[model samples]
Target: MTSITRLFDFPYYQQDKYISIPDALVTKQNGVWVKTSTEEYISKANAVSRALLRMGVKKDDKIAIISTNNRTEWNIMDIGVLQTGSQTIPIYPTISEDDYEYILNHSGAIYCFVSDIEVLRKINLIRNKIPNVLEVYSFNAIEGCKNWVELLKIGEDETNQYLVEEQKNKVQTEDLATIIYTSGTTGKPKGVMLSHRNIVSNVLNSAPRIPFEAGKSRALSFLPICHIFERMILYLYQYYGVSVYFGESIDKISDNIKEVKPTVITAVPRLLEKVYDKIYAKGTELTGIKKKLFFWAIDLGLRYEPYGANGVWYELQLKLARKLIFSKWKEGLGGNLDLMVSGSAALQTRLARVFAAAEIPVMEGYGLTETSPVISVNDMRNKGFKVGTVGKVIDGVSVKIAEDGEILCKGPNIMMGYYKDEKLTSEVIIDDYFHTGDIGEIDAEGFLRITDRKKEMFKTSGGKYIAPQLIENTMKQSRFIEQIMVIGDGQKMPAAFIQPNFDFVKEWAKIHKIEIGTTNEEITADPKVIARIQEEINRLNDKFGNWEKIKRFELTADIWSIEGGHLTPTLKLKRKIVMEKYIDLFHKIYN
Candidate 1:
């Protein structure tokens, strides 16, 4: 039996030692669900390796993959590149062309594979700028562009299978597997160099935490495969013989979930927030008894305690709530979503409680791309689950809170270092512990609770330190605020630039018979809307210390998005970019 030490060994191990499912990987194409059996997946990946070898791909060669959505092709290509002892550079498709140029050049990627015409076009715009990128291939066949199928066709001869094997044998568990450029909120994206051991250890260690039913478990993967969180989970799925289905896109996830009926999925907090908001909006449209029951269930869910800590009467009420209201919530999310792993940012505790109460457990985890992503995750078994914390540190990983409160981690999962940036890497990884730059604490029970980003906490002019993330998370519980950034560094008081939840605000306007205008600018400018948002802030402010309360706020007319240069691809706010974009509003709040 092949040991799962290297990233490329996962599929082979699954096929030889585990159940080989006919639907190991499924992707929607032209409105039809296409299945790739474990046999076909391995065969195709082998062919990709042979083709790359034939094309002169050598050890340490870098290959860039830029995809608009998660697909089987990306996964196959990933394994293929790894088998050749080459590094896979996964780039986010939503980033600016300048970023595309920077990553390709910085990694010296010899060849680039794109998922669609749009990504190809972006590459075409800067083809000349990145001199090291030898060629560009598209997963989707495009006129005048090289297609990935051409490589598969070249490898169909199978004459060079021995060469593929030779290279695969040369690959080591500690060898660099991928260079994932972090879509950071500020500055250039850092290429996080992760080894096969870094990720394989994470998958193996994190697997026991997730209750997978082996071959019977199904997962709908919609998160970006470029990110280690999703990419590592894909390997874990393969390792556990879980059938993986790729959602068509973010907009079509609802429909795809119903079609796939996956037993589990991974998501970011922002996506979960949107899902909850959509469901809550629908509940508000209910009438009389149904409406009361819906809100009652929501309130009950917000107060949920795991392990029946709320006692037998509360458990009985929760049972009734699940049947009467929360059951529909489960059904709406495919009726089979038993677990969801939330990461990449802080998840609202209310959101976590409500979803778990609905019987769809969302296990929030914490890690950076450099750590192969999973350091700790909330697990349900053996009192391992916690309501607000990120759960206990995974097996084989050690975490300690620094005197300054930054979470320091040392584990097999930690990256080798940032690519070609030894000076920068030295500053973060000290005494074998990676300074996570996240302020957090381990409770007496061993649950890790993240408080804020080390650099994001700011001091008011009066010398009081304010952790904006805690305040922001609390404020976002309101249905009115969609996005917010608290800005008050070196200022007299803390203030915020808020992007209202337009959909919910419109619904609220209808309920109140208020005549707020149609456009975002007009709605933000309306005194009634401003006053109502202020009321929400005032109510939630009591949760914080006097120095940390939001003293003033200004609403933004436009939504903050990745394309708008206000958020990273991971959906974290680009604080510098956001502040620059909302300078006028910032001045209005402080002045």
Candidate 2:
């Protein structure tokens, strides 16, 4: 695949003859998705840029966007910001108020964009703290603020057109494009400065790996656009002319998947886990021969290797398994899903193999916000793609394991540095290689396998090092376990604080005629429930050595989530916050 000939120029991508811009970019209108054609998209974006110029916005100014995936407006704002040689500072709509206040103040944003009236109210409440913000515009109409579309009318003023055109011509590959504040599972969010070169290089090189046939490939965008992984892919969609559909909301993905019938989609492991969990839960409801077949198909899936050759009989069994069982799984994912890319965290090897066996190719990749988010991805082509590894490093990127086993990468995709934090930047990027805190290994064929976070490994009282992530992942395989956090620092044995799959257990309690209380606390305290969880732990304990095995656990029906501060927006565990909140639970396990 050739590099984008125009290099770091984003606006120029609109002009590519090979890349067919659709008749309409989709957006919700009157409770139904509507399209605004390619010409309209360009005209609207250009008009918005002119409006910014009319508002006295200057080059290099920071414009903050506080919105969910309003695909049409978000892209228009992004291109508008680009045309003016200004930079966008995107804040996750779900972040804490204090965090939002910190980002606004720190970024020195002069103009802000919000998704709706509720978001506008949030900005209005925090307006005093962020004194530099001169104006707030709402994508949805609000009583107090300017509407985003009104800005387009400002661009129509003949006086502003010349300046917008002049500013658009000034955008260069080396110019600062955006400042992304990572939603770290721990500590304060740092702004990662990405230039046009950093993101464009990633998109152009990474786009080809994705099987996109112009006019045929459609993508359902659900991941937070604020995240680099989704944003980079958004650009790839633009470059390759893939029709994109914005999910209504996280809860509506099921309906949207069916409506869009996307050939390709991107997701985090948690979403895929939910899909698996739902299917597993349904399968558990079957009985006799049907129940046996369900589990049998699942077991075969876990053993199915795409690259390795199983015997003729095994292959035949797999074929039967796909027809009888796996076909239903595909239909659930909208019947057109050819590729589902999972990233932001390590996908469980079991899930990866099972999905591949079902003929739903899940390409698990690895990277962080700092690496423009894709260091490596499993190729859907199945040529040499490994299930457990994060595939071979992408073209033009060099990855190696440090002596300490941390994955270090150097490439055009690497961010310039931490915005306005040189000392912190120097700590991570040494001799041009960005030190990824993940501990991983490169196999002989060049696939990368991430084991655990370098800082997350803890030692037991017996002086044996244990990776909690490994234990947590293994334990979560149980249908009863929704989330688990392993705990044991200088202790006799490792214990876990677990969030139970309450709905699943509720059904089990009824079937067994085990009376339990209504609330989470009461349900978790039931003796029968405890016994059932113990059985699961005992089964999983076979996979680990005695030192690494979880000796005990405290179950809770309390779900961990991003809003609860127990999870990052990307769904990685916020271990520190979770530990602080559940000290008593941990004590119960250890005691």
Best by lDDT: 1
Tens digit of per-residue lDDT, candidate 1, span 481-514: 9999999999999999999999889989998899
Clashes of each: 0, 2
Model 2: per-residue lDDT, tens digit, 350-384? 99999999988898888888988888888867574
| Candidate 2 positional error at 516, Å | 2.1
What lDDT score is found at residue 531 in candidate 1? 98
Clashes by residue pair, model 1: none
TM-score of 2: 0.96
Q: How accurate is candidate 1 locally (lDDT)?
A: 0.94
lDDT against the true structure, per candidate, is 0.94, 0.84
